[model samples]
Target: MERKRSNRGRWTSVATAVIWIGTTGGASGHEIKVLASQLLTAPGSRDTVYLSWGHIVPVDMPIDAETIKDYRLHTPSGSVNYLSTEGTSLHANVVTVDEEGLYTAEVIRHPSIYTLVIDETGHRHATGSKVEAAKLGGTVDYSARSHQFAKALLISGDAHEGSTKVLGHEFEIVPLDGPESWVAGSDLRVRVLFQGKPAARQDVFARYIGFKPDQAWCFAIPTDNDGIATIRVDRAGTWIIRAQKTLPAALEDRALFDLESYTASVALEVLP
Candidate 1:
């Protein structure tokens, strides 16, 4: 049997842990994010991008390839490339850029049900159905239909013409600034959108690549009425920005779950 890597790691550095926790409001779980080794590359460079589930650590746990409902690469010339990884391990997709413009990689996952139940003995269980867990003498603690969307920004050269365009995600975090704004000590602004409109007062979370795995995020802030959140690019490295929105389940879905969750994450590289 292939041994599974333990998802929980120790907080070896107290100072790092304290700083991250203080800014991020403590660590949480179940974050879906896109993963890439390098985002800024030259033309004809091949980049392998993967999807990780259950944590914001860009390369945490690779999800099953079958879970991907859509994978696409949007180009600066307004062309879209449909990508697939049928024969690859864990369905990781690879892209080779031939143009000198900003490229966006988007991945949409199939919706799934996640449920937590607490039994009489006070033990918690993870199940797929809240109704079934309730019948099994377990009190339903939380249940939701989780929908995840992930994106990564890759710049081939200096052409950043389409860096600020919306890609039509159901729930999205669009970077309003271009690669020029990704410098350390600069303010990188992003807007959250839900159903194609501004998502006001949305909570946005971010962290750099070297952040400890035991921490939740390096920074946390909420968007203003215009749905814009300003994140300080404090370091010159890869960063992941994430946001989530949850709503009550539809009438028909109420029996299966209590709510619906939509999560979005964007990964990019920052220069010093």
Candidate 2:
């Protein structure tokens, strides 16, 4: 199970909006970012959104081919299916948004991270050999470790007026585009939401992952009472926004000296 309730920061006892991180789990070094041409669309108007998975924090290595197939876009009306993909971009067509809700271009699973662990029940050998468990619960055991994996979920959604919480989990720093979503010479407002609510006073970080005039174009911003942050887009490039937090485990998870840490991010390619 996920870590139990605690008095620690970030990972404190959750209410309706529950955000989580495993006690001893590892995270992916990459993330998926969404791009929409126009966020504020007229009712029944058609628009396009793109999904990019080659967005790794600290570095952006774009892939020359398709990296995902099950990507989608969640709108107020319904979901938009994938139309086509070019290189690392997965294109999805948004038909219309008749209602007054937020439109989100999102993906549930993107960067999958794995690790080896020692646990009860014998595991299979690397060479496809069946190995019997000589011990249980690491009692009088030889070596005990099994492999487990964790996947990261990223969502980049924004509304023209009120930003809705359509898809959000893990430690996500969603960039809320303004009237000029990704246009050059504009300031973008970003929000770091935990679960489905604003994370006030949280430290939000942004950096240019792709090519930029200055390699040191990294900055940190803090969320306000509304859990929203703002950053100015000086030049056009791939902007990466991120945030992280850690907390002590609950009583049950204390056995392994568990420490839960969560990290989340999204990428945006500002047009020149």
Candidate 3:
């Protein structure tokens, strides 16, 4: 199939509508996510997928191609297709749908180590090397190796089985039910998985477009022992649900970092 180019003005409008619902898991630092021009579309239509990276909003943050470990599309037919990317300014790619079903756009970022040091003199320094921060004779306020995963859903005609397919991402959020009919005041059932197993007792945060900018999230819920979280769809608009897992570093890695963290997010659209 021939690739399509996304119009800058069209993307600007779609991006403006979903920026309110964008998320980057952690309280500090930038996070990456995938967003589409539209969640619902017709057969033979094209959708522009954006790999957005930023703190809380989906601004035009330029992403280094090397940082993107993987970017692909999972089609309704179960075929995996790699995206031919274009435009680093938005990190955008376009995909076309010829049949009717749901498609998933997924992205994985290379694991990166980050540390924050607060010296005795009350000055803070941020660096990618924890060992370097330790040599400053300062307090390691935060030190963790981060793994990020993101996904966005696009429906061509109707929602289908692809929504529940486990794509084998180290950390992922899977919708238990189809999102084709999600609407305001409804409840969305989702599962958090880590290393192909259910991630039990995890914290999940969610927000919708137009939510309060000062607030971290509009809804906060924890997964049950089965890794299930029932998020109440508060209002109509684009919505994103994110989850994070943090663990103490292994004995060998302790010398380099204090903790390892995994974060995952999924974007959905809810009708009024």
Q: All predictions: root-mean-square deviation over Cα?
A: 7.9, 12.5, 9.3
Q: Work out the TM-score per prediction.
A: 0.84, 0.48, 0.83
Task: Locate the minimum summed-lDDT window of 10 residues in model 1.
Answer: 1-10
Q: What 10-residue stretch in candidate 2 is worst by lDDT?
A: 141-150
Ranking by lDDT: 3, 1, 2
lDDT of 1 by residue, 63-126 (tens): 6667778888888777998877564244567777888888888889888777767776774545
**Residue 83 of candidate 1: its Cα lDDT?**
72
Identify the superior model by lDDT, candidate 1 or candidate 3.
3
Name the runs in model 3 displaced over 4 angstroms: 1-28, 85-88, 119-125, 134-138, 160-163
For candidate 2, lDDT tens digit of each residue in 1-272?
11221122122212101221222112322345555555444555566655544334332455333444344555555555444456553444444445544554554443222222344554221211113222222222111121111111112243343333435465566666533366555667877767778888876656665523322224555689998887655556656665655455455644332334455565555667
How many clashing residue pairs appear in each of the predictions shown?
A: 0, 4, 0
CA error at residue 1 for candidate 3, angstroms:
51
Candidate 3 residue lDDT tens string, 1-272? 11122233323434443443444333235778888888778999888887778755455377878788888888888888897555455667777887788788899989988886777676454657688777767778767888999998777786655246778899999998886557676678899999989999988877775665633566766799999998777567778888888888898998788888888999888877
lDDT of each: 0.74, 0.46, 0.76
Where does model 1 exceed 4 Å of error?
Answer: 1-29, 87-89, 120-127, 135-137
Candidate 2 residue pairs in backbone clash: 117-145, 117-146, 118-144, 118-145
TM for candidate 1 is 0.84
Alpha carbon deviation, residue 145, candidate 2 (Å): 16
